[model samples]
Target: MGTDETTGAEPRATLEGFLRARRDRVRPEDVGLPGSGRRRVPGLRREEVAILAGVSTDYYMRLEQGRERNPSPQVLDALARALLLDGEATDHLHRLALAGGRRSRGAARPERVNPHLLRLLDRWSDTPAFVLGGTLDVVARNRLAAALHADFTVTDNLARMTFLDPAARGFHRDWDRSAAAVVAELHKAAGARADDPRLSALVGELSLRSTDFRTLWARHDVRGKSGGAKRLHHSAVGPLDLHYESFTVNNADGHGQQLVVYQAEPGSPSEEALALLGSLHTLYPENGPEAGAGTRTGRA
Candidate 1:
């Protein structure tokens, strides 16, 4: 790769800094490596790391210095083991590798909302529901999600539109909780991909647009959003209270992608309200995606 000597802010430098910092924090005493003499550097040397990680000393040195950014999965795994990384830290290593300004292998396609999943969504056509990705992208939605959150997809990103969209101002009954959830999810994603360009780009956009997102991001909250509830205001359907559940379908093909679905409690007013919404979908099937047809996704 040709070096752009004039570029002052390089992403690899940030990745290099992270790698070196992680290297410096641990000593030979920590992982049973031999420390023969008093060390001059703060952390293990290039050769020490290489030995522990089962890599060539020269290659390890090049990686730490940001000269070789594309380390294979096996190599990364070995390095993580050598570094004694926990689960979260290991995930962060991948994120850092992706974010280190290196183009990664293309991501698997956005999951298709399968017929079974769509049928499940269809079963609750009255419920205000949608599916969200880890990055807060609106992957799928029922009619109610669209009616209540009209500008949600048009704004391109869920987190951005949630905090910055004018429609969202009154749509979400609880802004603080909603904001926290979004930021928390972002925090968790960032840890996994400290170097992901797309994620970094989204965070940068949110930081510029919404102070609330920036503040929450600084808190370093990690959230694996399995489920939650929200009260929504729809111009057509009025107000409806609903609870949602998220399931991460095991995409053997993809890294970490999840599909979220929502439901209303049985026998409650929301449930009754949801029933009414289901009726509308059956009668007015032409309103949603594929015009009364639902997309199926995942094995579930």
Candidate 2:
């Protein structure tokens, strides 16, 4: 999403943007609207969306134009259905509508990692584990986890590394999928803590630096924490396949802090790779080398 030329600032993400983006992605044929020839807009027309949502054309148009901020729950539900929004997308729509069309841009309190959690991460010698802050900032990481993500110039911020770091594109075997996932997670975080200045700044920086980030951010996809397998190519250990599980730390000093742990199956090649990574990690600590060293400070 580009900025308003008049303002010379990135347009604040609004409910209107969300609606327009989603609407642009849907087609008339997909929603049972009769195909039209040479339409000016990309997706279904505003009138078609209004019809599908059982609302007046003027009312729906107002919603998209930002003339109307809040929409009733019934209207939102109808719009969600009309747009064929998935559970995550539908939830995000509700959040945006209830938020009065704009993400909170207020300053947020600082986050601190719990010492006990750090100790726990340390105890997981074989497994790769790290704690992430609200905006997916790497709050803390164990030795193995540090080694696992050693390729990136800055491992402190996952979103930054995924978009800004060239090594990240090659490090993540499924580069496109990983990029989308990071943006979706960031969207979910923004919905919950939009007022956080750190999050806002991170979004602004990425929106400006990377066109890819802008394109994906405009998609408004929201995703929650869940375990999944990943394929990563490490320079030292070659390719490795591992599964990770994420756990939320409730009432932690940091908002939306999550603990992510990566593991490989026993007797597998990935397991051997993990062992090698651990051995190498002990010899070359994450903080020793300038090139491989990652920042401990919070960037978001």
Candidate 3:
């Protein structure tokens, strides 16, 4: 989502741009209205959209114009259904609405993990260690995570896969449980930042596209994703039952970043598989000579 001439760096304008683009794609006839004469704005009228979404024309106008940034989850959903956005579009909208002030998408370009922490991953090659966001976006994963949840990182979001990806249906042994977790994380984000325009748009898009998402969201389940057990069927290692621990890193700037680690039982085939992954990880070649090894802190 690119911003334009007058838009600020607050991320609100990018969301506005997306909404305007989607708003343009839908013709009047697509939603049961017969085409009349040449019109200025392409799709539905402001009043029509506002009425359909159960919002005031002035407020919706401000939203479309990027003047207003706060819209509740329910209002965003109403707008999404009215716009007829697909699952991916819906998720994008939600991410935008929940992004707060962060500009670039997908977790502020993803802060790099510490070298020592990465070393830990290198050591535990038989285990799975990856960083996942509150949305279960597989931020980064080691060899074992790639093996266990093969398709997790391929997509931008876990919820998007639950609705759109074919492999998700097959790969996730407990599909319902996975789906519930996805929705719960999304709900938590929504609760945390009720005014994020991007988050609002994403929720709207998902609700319109997937009936399953709609049903799950309606349950009002809110929970943070931290630790859990995942039963994985690796094409190479067969089946593995592993427990996971997910914790947030205290970014120097106070951003809530997390590091998720997964481990298998000792003397298990999963552990052996992890070892193979570690061996492979050690050969990655990018673990070059430490560049900033000699910095000294001044005494207070």
Candidate 4:
């Protein structure tokens, strides 16, 4: 992501900041522009971007300055191409442009998990499953999911755990890659929930407290919940390799939640590890990793 002076600014200001940040990240050579040693600013200049995007420099400047709030879809598509944005980044750009309409109406209400969804999680005792809210908060989880993530003192927020928790380095076998991915996903979520106060507070806290998180956040990377593989080192069960699938939970409530389920190969060592973890969960139902931890409610 590109950087601009958007802290505490409204949706329009945030839109500006994102554009500047992304523009700063693109080098002259990156977009086939000649690298001039006499350049004064980092990344491509505003004129350069305007030229590439096939728009007037003044018009493009207005977009970043918040003088122009809406651009035609064709113009936006051109800007996206000029910026070399991927699918996720392009989607985020569109959301920011539209967020102004929603942000002015009112803040969004907090999200809650469905009771039926909770019951479904309980029934999947063999599989580790959890639900994540917009802020990547652990809103709901099965016993196995709790056990899988029990090593962390705070299982409520995944982003905090990845950056602030010391155990995260060992827990995630590929810490750097996972950390980057988590940061990117948070960026994507924030774009969708631009007016959510909770999201703002979380971003602020992480930016102030963790240097690594601050660095990643500035990159303006955007990613959504998707299927992937993870290698984990559990405190009790040792090493385990698992694959995960993420599903969007769509219902009348419009919670916009993601259901993430983890599974291991049937005859693999990871499967054996999962069974052992399950047994421990059963034996120490009261003192286990997620013992008595109720589901999280409200906005992240």
Candidate 5:
């Protein structure tokens, strides 16, 4: 019942919040349960979920109220099945259950990109690559990556850029999909780091500023960053269809870092545009069209 210092608001318990939001998404028909006409709430009732999970209604109610902690693996599995969660969402549910009300003790150390990774990024002159910290902060980027994101006013955090920057709507061709994916990634991060102050602050800022962010966040979607195709409209290069692969950087310190690289199909128009962009970057290293125009400092 403690208040969140970061947001100065009463914070919802992680497990309870997740359970409620997810429960609201599942319809009675989703689990082969016949519809009981005219329910006040969306999705299945607590009794319905308990029935599906093979647990007592009281126990399930306690679980949703944050009074019941330390659910066994068997119970967790049953709940996952009852909720019809996918692999990622199931894993996230387990993580939240295992967290056991942990809280952040102090400020986290600033994230730094590995020197070898930086060298690798620089070597891929034709590709766009960048390193992202746990909270999707762009810790480091190669010249090509910088050029790829030249339209962004703040290139620090992907979530911030997607939700807070005006250029994002134009830059991301599928704005709705991009926005949902960004929020879903953040949702996954929040499950792992429930009490992380920086993350809480970021979520609070986005929730306050963007209606779209609030709507997506409320869905409680969980997804990790992985290989995917992106359709982007660059200010200089027009539309560019690219595939990106994300690799985890296994640092000695065990910090969460991901190296993301973007590539275009060979002989495609996107590839030609990318090559043109690289040439432009090389021609004007500091003050050319590739330069990050209207760049501004962002929150760490």
Candidate 6:
């Protein structure tokens, strides 16, 4: 395991941290075990997890303590079953175990959206489309997307806008759900590249600044942004119920760029509202110094 350069102490292994967090979320009765007596911890005891996973208590302890880093696939599967982890979380577990404290080899370069992709986004004049970099940075966005997110003080990063921007609560009708999903998506990305300095810095900033972010981040939930519905209260449109789809950009650079597009349901009130928003933008185009002045739209 790697040691912290400043402290000269070993950092907690990623696999160990993930295992401990997941273990703390599994209740005794969740896996058909008896929940009879009072316990010091919130979730299943370590020994109980061992029993459920069909592993020795000592071995399980070693796994949690980072002393044992190379568990076989069978053991990983058993542990996933024991913890009742979902598909995404199970995959995250396998990734952490496979990483085994190895840091990424080279420094990361700034992500650039392909010109072709930018043109594609511009073609969707009525839709809100943007490209998100590996650390959830808004690398490129169409005019509609820019207009939608005009309320944010900093639109460069989605995670920052979601947690730090004061407008986030007002924009996202379901603020709590939005917060949890953002944290979980960031967790999944961070898990894949544990040593990315940008991710580390962003996580640290959010953890220090937002109490809600700290709480959700500690849970270690892992999920990707695929497709979902969003309920938003736009400053101009009043209310919008939009569905969004995310696609991974298959670039040779492997920077994990994602193309996200948002649309309203056909014939719904939200569709009318969206159209009105588009028309408003067309009539009063935000150009020069006035672009992205006082509007508010959130990333779903």
Worst 10 residues of 1 by lDDT: 291-300
Off by over 4 Å in 2: 1-11, 101-105, 283-300
lDDT order, best first, reads: 2, 5, 6, 4, 1, 3
When summed lDDT is taken over every stretch of 10 residues in candidate 5, the lowest stretch is: 287-296
Across 1-300, the per-residue lDDT of candidate 6 in tens digits comes to 343454332222277878888899988888898778878988888998899999999999999988997999899999999999999998888888877756565557757667677678768878888888888887777777777776667676888899999999999999999999998888888667776777776776776677788778878888999999999888887889999999999971787989999999999999888777777665432221222221223332
The clash numbers for all candidates, in the given order, read 10, 0, 19, 6, 0, 1
> Residue 130 of candidate 6: its Cα lDDT?
80
Residues 203-300, candidate 4: write the lDDT tens digits.
Answer: 87677667788778877788897999999999999999999999998851554688899999999999999999988666422222222233443222
TM-score of each: 0.57, 0.89, 0.51, 0.88, 0.90, 0.88
Worst 10 residues of 2 by lDDT: 286-295
1-300 per-residue lDDT for model 1 (tens digits): 112233311212144554666687678888897767878987687788899999999998888778987888888889878877666656666766766555554333444444555566555555555555546665566665555455343434567777777777577778788888887677666555554556656676666666676656544445667777887765555676877777775642343555566667788877776666555554442224532222222210
lDDT of 1 at 80: 79
How much lDDT does each candidate structure score? 0.62, 0.79, 0.58, 0.78, 0.79, 0.78
Of 1 and 2, the candidate ahead on lDDT is: 2
Q: Which whole-number lDDT from 0 to 100 does residue 51 have in model 2?
A: 93
Residue 138 Cα positional deviation in candidate 2, in Å, after optimal superposition: 0.7
C-alpha lDDT (0 to 100) for residue 254 of candidate 2: 46
**Which 10 residues in a row give candidate 6 its minimum summed lDDT?**
287-296
Estimate candidate 3's alpha-carbon lDDT, on a 0 to 1 scale: 0.58
Question: 1-300 in candidate 5: lDDT tens per residue?
Answer: 444454443233277778888999999999998877889879989998999999999999998888987898889889889999999998888888876555555556666656676678778889988777777777777778888888888677899999999999999999999899988888888777776677777787787777788778878889999999999999999999999999989981444778889999999999999998998776423222211221224542
Residue 177 miss distance in model 4 (angstroms): 1.2
Q: Highest TM-score among the candidates is held by which one?
A: 5
lDDT for 238 (candidate 6): 88
